[model samples]
Each structure stands twice: as structure tokens, then as C-alpha cells.
Target: METNTQTDQVTNYVYIHVPFCLRKCSYCSFFSVNFSQEASSRFVKYLIKEINLFKQKYNIKPKTIYFGGGTPSLLTAAQINLIISQFDIAETEEITLECNPVNITNEFAKELTLTQINRISLGAQSFLDKELKVLGRLHKADEIRNAYKLLRAYRYNNISLDLIYGLPNQTKEDVEFSLDEIIKLEPEHISTYCLSLEKDVPLFSKIDQIPADEKVAEFYYLIRNKLISAEFEHYEISNFAKSGFESNHNLCYWNDKYYLGFGPSASGYLDFNSKTVCHPERSRRRDHLIRYNNSVNFEIYHKMLDEKKIMIDKIILNNDDHEKEYIFLGLRKAAGLNLEEFENKFKTDFTKKYDKVLHKFNNLLEINERTIKLKSEAYFISNEIFSEFM
Candidate 1:
């Protein structure tokens, strides 16, 4: 275990990664795996031990506790409680748990409600059976409705539904239909993602059958217009929330706030004074999360979590990188980047640095007094515009 400090001196958020799944997705590639109950049990014990070390090192209670994962729903409510009991989170803190429809039951939802788990992120990739099969999802279309009904019956209001577009053989009508059902459900939040042909995934092998980039872009615009017209806030590129339901955990990542991640393949970030580590990478999937372990492989992760360690394995950001990170991450939000806030974090004039990139990409990006936005047309080409920062 190691210790670090942020210049801000604030302890705000913590993330718990549950890298266990009933089964892995064909298109998915994150740290997770199928495992036995005994293994899952051991992993929980290890998580608590690791967290205790973190608490001692950081010396603060996290205001937000997020359980993100391969499939947090795989754990029984009792197991969830046991893992959470180890943390000293504030009573009013936001606690979230991610689940798939297949594991969501009335009993499960009820137990979660009683366990201080206020937020539920449902992996309802699509309500269509065909899409589910193509995506290698285990849940059926009916399962999705049942899952939501169960949550709603438990009086759970802070719910988020995930949607995926650009699937193979999917049509515009398919995307619209899914969105229509989502709008009718009126979930507090919706996270829309375009499928990426990630390396080594089963879905990546059938790349030729997937929707073309142009068609995928069309659906992207469709989602934005539909969600906006339905009164959802396009708070981030991939997230749409109703006013107050924006994801606090994800915000930590985009805003570069300090957070601790527990469980295998999970990465923790602590701000230690002037310098910081932005993104951390993992090589193995979190199989033991399903079956709890005594401890995560700390030595492997120490390099990434070490205080003020330079962000390597990808492009390193200088002052240009910082300015670009602010713009890139900031534009993903509806409020956009606060210029004053940007200047404060990077200690550089935004207009003075990367003026060429900003100027050349002006049509694609909208620079307001307090915020920078991607024009409606640029949302599809957002990656290209953001690449300028890189």
C-alpha cells in the first residue's frame, strides 16, 4: 500500500470494481470472468483487506461509493452488504450498484433497497431479443421489463439504463425502437454507447457484418435528438440524465478527481499535490471478484497507483495534453469546460496554448465564454476533433 495527496486536499469519491460475471460478453473486454461461489467469497475478503489499507493511507471517508463491474449483480445482497460494511462512507453518500437484468429479481431489489444501495445501473443493452443474442447477452427482452418493474416496485428512482448502437445487422428502426421503449420507461439516466471493435473480442472477428461507420453516426445523431427532445440532459457524450441523475462516479473520471478502485483490474487514483496520474491500465481480467480472494495482486498495480507516477502506455500529455484533456473531457459534458476552472487546473491560458488546434477545429467545436461545445454535426466526428488534442 502507498499514500498520496491531491493539491485540492479533498476526499470525495471511491469506486469498487466487481469483476465477476455469469458469463463474459462476446463484444466485451474488461477485467472479469466466470467463477465459483467459493472463489467469489474469497475475493470479497481480499477487497476488504485492500480497502482497509486504503482507508489508513488516505485518511478520509468517501462521499460516493460506486460498485462497477463485470457484473456486480452476480453477488447476493448479503455479499454486497459484507463488502460495503468494510467502508466508512458517509450516511448521505451516493451508493451505486451495477446489475444485469438476468440477476435482477424482486427479492434482490428489495434487499438492495434495504442495504443503502440507492442507485442501480442496469445493463439493458437493448430491449430487442435479436440484438441481445448478437451481443451475447444472457437476458431476454421480457427480462428487461421485469427487472425494471422490480426496481420500480422497490421504489428505486435513481436508475440508469445502458443502450448500445452500431451492432451487426441493426437498423435505424432498431435504435429508435429501443429508445422509444427507454423513453417510455423514463429511467433517471441513459448511457448510450457506440460499439467499438475492440481487439481480441469475439464480435471483433465479425467486423464485416457490423454496421458501417456512416450508419452508426446516423444513429448517434438520432439518439441525441431523441433524448434531448424527451427532456433528458445530454450531460456527457455517452450519458444522458434527467437533471440531477448524472453519474457521480463517471464524473470523477472526467473531472480528474481522486478515487480509489478495489478488486482485480480496478485502478485507484489519488491526487498527491502538484502532479497526478490520469488513466491506469490493467492486463488481466478480474476473475476472482466472483469468488472473493484475500488480496488483489498489489505489486502488479503499484506501478499504476504510485503517487505522481507519469501516465505512460499511451500518449503523454504536456501542457498541451492538459489543455486538450480539459477540452476533450469537458466537451463531453453539457455544461462544457469552465474556462476559469481549466486555467486553474493546468495553469495555462487555453487560448494561448494549442491555438492552432482550436482555431483549425473551430467549426467542429464551439468555444463559449465559460464552456466549449461540439457542434451538432461534430458529435459523430468527435473523436477526430478530440484527436487534435492528442
Candidate 2:
């Protein structure tokens, strides 16, 4: 990490990545190794060391902590407590852990609640058994509901359900069935993602087997309308939340707040304290923003953590690119870009700066005195709109 100093403004957000999985889903691309008692124990020790080293290095007090993973639920309750005890967090901090159905147990859930894990984001990809099989999930469909009941039994009310649409051989009926099941469970948050077949994943070669582009578009629209009717706010492009339930941890990223990341294969963006070049919504003391990535290889990560000699891949952003990124990220939110905030931060006239691109997307984007956002009808093509900023 780049060395910097400030009397105030220490990094206030933290993410710890756990890269161990029992089985890597066929469509998944996250880094991971097989889970085992010995390996997991060592990983926990190294993570504790890594977190302490960075905490001392940066003097951070985390306001929100997310335990993201190949499968964070793989950790035993004792291990979770051991790692979380290292952090200096507030009493009201949002501590979230990820889980999959196969790994959840009623006893484990009870133990987890005792460790201060106030939130759970379950990877219940689909509520349909056939779809689960196609997605290579190890758990059966009924287990999703069972796991939800278990979490509720442990008083984890702030739960998020993760689902995927645009799947191979998926139908509109399937989409409705899944959403109906989700509404019945009544989680505080819903994150629906389109299936993208990236290179190297097992699903890439069989793209031809999936739903057509138009069909996927319909699925996206249906989900948006249904989720809205269910009283969930489409706060971000891929995320919906009940009122007052938006994810603070993820909002930090979209809002351009500085954060720290730990563990192998994890990434962080810190620094860049300065007034926005064109907009005045932000004023700060950051000099430059740098994004850094830790070593993805496990052995190298452990060695560095043990010796306190970690190396990172760094990219320092320049002013123009940074301004562009601010636009790019802000546009991904359902609340859209605040025009006055944009102009003030970048110190440019919004209407005049990119008139051509704005004109090109006039119909697809909604612009008003207070905001500029993608029209709900145009959200399925948000990627195309995002590329204009890129």
C-alpha cells in the first residue's frame, strides 16, 4: 500500500476476502482452492496477521466490514469470531457474511449470530431445482428455503438474496416462480444479476444454449417491475432493497469513498483527497487515488503476510480519468447522477461538457434539475450507456 498521512480521514471501510471453496461452481470465476481443516486454519491465522498489519499501517477504524468469499460460510463460528475480534468497529457496524445453502446449518447459524454477524448474503442463485442443476450448485432447491428459515430462526433479519436471470433454458415462468419464492421469504435486500459468460468459464463454450438476447431483456424488465411492485427500491443497477436497507458497504464503492481490502485476490482503492475538478459535492484533502491488488497466489500471500512484506499491483488515477470514473460509477445507481453535484465536483458545465454524448442518449436517459439517470426502460442496456463514459 502507498504510504500516506492525515490527521483525520483514515480508511473507514474494510473487506476481507476468503478464497476457499468446497466446490467451484461451473460458472464462477472467483479465485479459490479446495476447503480443508488444515488449510482453512492457516488461512485464518494469515488473515488475522494481514488485517493487523494493515490496521497498524493505515490506522483504520472500519464502519462496515464485509466477509466476501468463494464461500465465507465455510468458516467455523470460532474462526469467524477470531478474525472479527481484530477489528476496531462501532457498535452499530454492519458486519456481513456470505453463505451458500449447502453449508448452512441451524447450529452454525446460532453460533454465527453470537459472533456479531448481523447480516447474511446468501447465494441462493435460483429457487428452481432444474435451474440450480444447470448452474452447477451443489445444494437442491428446497435447501434455499430451509436455509432462509434457519437464518430467521437465528434472528438475522437483515438478509439479502442473490439471484441470477438470463440463464440457459430459463423461462419467463421460471423467472416468476423464483421471484415469487423470494417475495415469500421477504429478505431485506434482493440482488438480481444478468448471466454473463466470460472467457475461461465452463459456460462460455455453450453460450448458444442460453436464452436469446431479447428474451433476457424481457427477463430484466419483468424483474425490475415486479421488484418495484413488491416495494423494493432498485437502488443500484443490479441491487434492490427495502426502504432503509441499501447496502452501506457497496454504496461506499459507488460513492467513491476510500476503503481498505485484505487477503489474497482482494482489491482496494485508497487516497485521492482533493476537490472534485468539476463538481462541488465533494471537497477533501486526498492527493491521488490508487487502486491496489494483493497477490492472488496463496503461497505468496501467506509468505508476505507472515513476513509483513506484502507486494501489491498499483494503478494511480489521473485527474481526467478519475473524473470520468466518478461519472461511470454514479450512473450505475438508480438514483442516477445529481447534475448540480456533478457540475460542482468536476467544475464543468454538465450540459456543455459532453453535449454530443448526452444528445445521443437523450431518449434513453432521464435528465432533470436534480438528477440524470437511465430511464427504467433503458436499464437493460445500461452497459452500452456506461461505455460512453469509458
List the lowest-lDDT window of 10 residues for candidate 1.
285-294
Candidate 2 C-alpha lDDT tens digits along 1-390: 333332245788888898899987878888888999898998898988878766545667888889998889999999989988897776437888999888888888888877988889999989898888878889887999999999998888899999999888889999989999998899999999898878888877768878998999999888889999999999998999999999989998888788878888998887644222212433432236678788889888877776765435667776677788888888889888888888777788877887888899999988887888888877888878878866
Q: Name model 1 segments beyond 4 Å from true.
A: 1-9, 273-323
lDDT of each: 0.75, 0.83
If scored against the real structure, what TM-score would every candidate get? 0.86, 0.92
Per-residue lDDT over 273-307 for candidate 1, one digit per residue giving the tens place of the 0 to 100 score: 22223223211311111111213453443443333
